[model samples]
Target: MTVVAHPTDPTPARAPAATRTAGRIRGLDAARALAIFGMVTVHFGPFPVRGDDLASAAYRTPYGRASVLFAFVAGVGVALLSGDGSAPRVRSAGRRLVLRAALLFPLGVALQKLPTGVAVILQYYAIYFLIAAAALRLADRWLLALAGSLTLAGPMAIVLAQRAEPSWFDAGGNVGIRAPVALLRALVISGYYPVLSWAPVVLFGIWIGRRDLHAPGVHRRLVACGAG
Candidate 1:
């Protein structure tokens, strides 16, 4: 899928970085930027955009949606990085994604130890990457089916898990690796962005990522879905 500089170019097999960037969808870039801004607003404050009267309203906009957007965008990234679902090199992609997770998990743990009150989401993000690695091997229909099932069952499962073991949830707040089992519980069920509940969003993003996004028909369908 390399975009050569010209039809007769000798290096048609490999596109330059600039050439690749030129071919990128600007809309996706805007979405990613907006999502990042929203995350920053949630983590810090929307001070730059606020007036005295509109402060509360501004803060409310990105509250819960930021993390969700991040999850979705992360899924899209996974798809694009692994060659856009056409004919993924699953083993290679899995290895790369797992290595990223391995690096991120420890870093996330360290960030959690900081005095800053923000709940570190990087650890959960690491888990999501691992999930994406596994998901890269699935067909589109299966991915959609899995996402739908998770959407229905994940939140319910979390609620039940919390009710059954309140102490585990409590331990989740204590950010340390001393209790590995409790850490696992928190990551999967009790943490701020638990994988059980959030994985579907990522899966849906992967589904979206698989599509021919450049198509006008696809854009129309996406718009219709949003409106519905």
Candidate 2:
């Protein structure tokens, strides 16, 4: 007796990554737009309540939130640029990031000279960008862990620094380009957007960007975690 063999169906191929509209992620753009708009309002919007200005809708809603989103977005951008841990490309990207940081340092100082009322972020952002180069090769879990660690450590350091030197953070408006010591202090420990505390957000973003963001499971997790 001879037995017949049955044929099995072939596996299906996966579709390529999807982008919103065309060649871009609308969700990212929308979040960025919210951040930018919030920052603008925080700076240029009116203060109906004198000493209570900070508690106003604009400041209360976006003052810190926008900056966090902006930093996270920046990290995500870097992760994408690095091709999600592609070492060879990250090396080349790191060079570009270094040059960009160099340019931003002076530009931030220059912006300070312009008498802009808002606290400038470019200088601190430059430092954050440079630091990111060192961690570009870390796995997503490690990046997330570091972010969590930094988040906890940042506030503690801030408290200690304040106790050590209360006046170190006060800028009296803007510290000119000549004040390197004050500038460094502000970048590391104090200032509206201290890289000390904010660095974690950036790392978390880099980790998030490396994941399969378009997938339903990932999206669900992002929403749940973001809300938490």
Residues 28-105 of candidate 2: C-alpha lDDT, one tens digit per residue: 788899999888877776543666555575667786788889999998777666763456877987887888899998
Q: What C-alpha lDDT values do all the predictions have?
A: 0.75, 0.72
Clashes of 2: 0
Score residue 128 of candidate 1 by CA lDDT: 93
How well is each residue in 95-125 modelled by candidate 1, as lDDT tens digits?
Answer: 8889999999998978887888778888888
lDDT of 1 at 178: 78
TM-score (all chains, Cα) for each model: 0.83, 0.81
Which residues of candidate 2, in runs, are more than 4 Å off?
1-23, 49-59
How well does candidate 1 match the true structure, expressed as C-alpha RMSD? 7.8
Q: Which is the leading candidate under lDDT?
A: 1
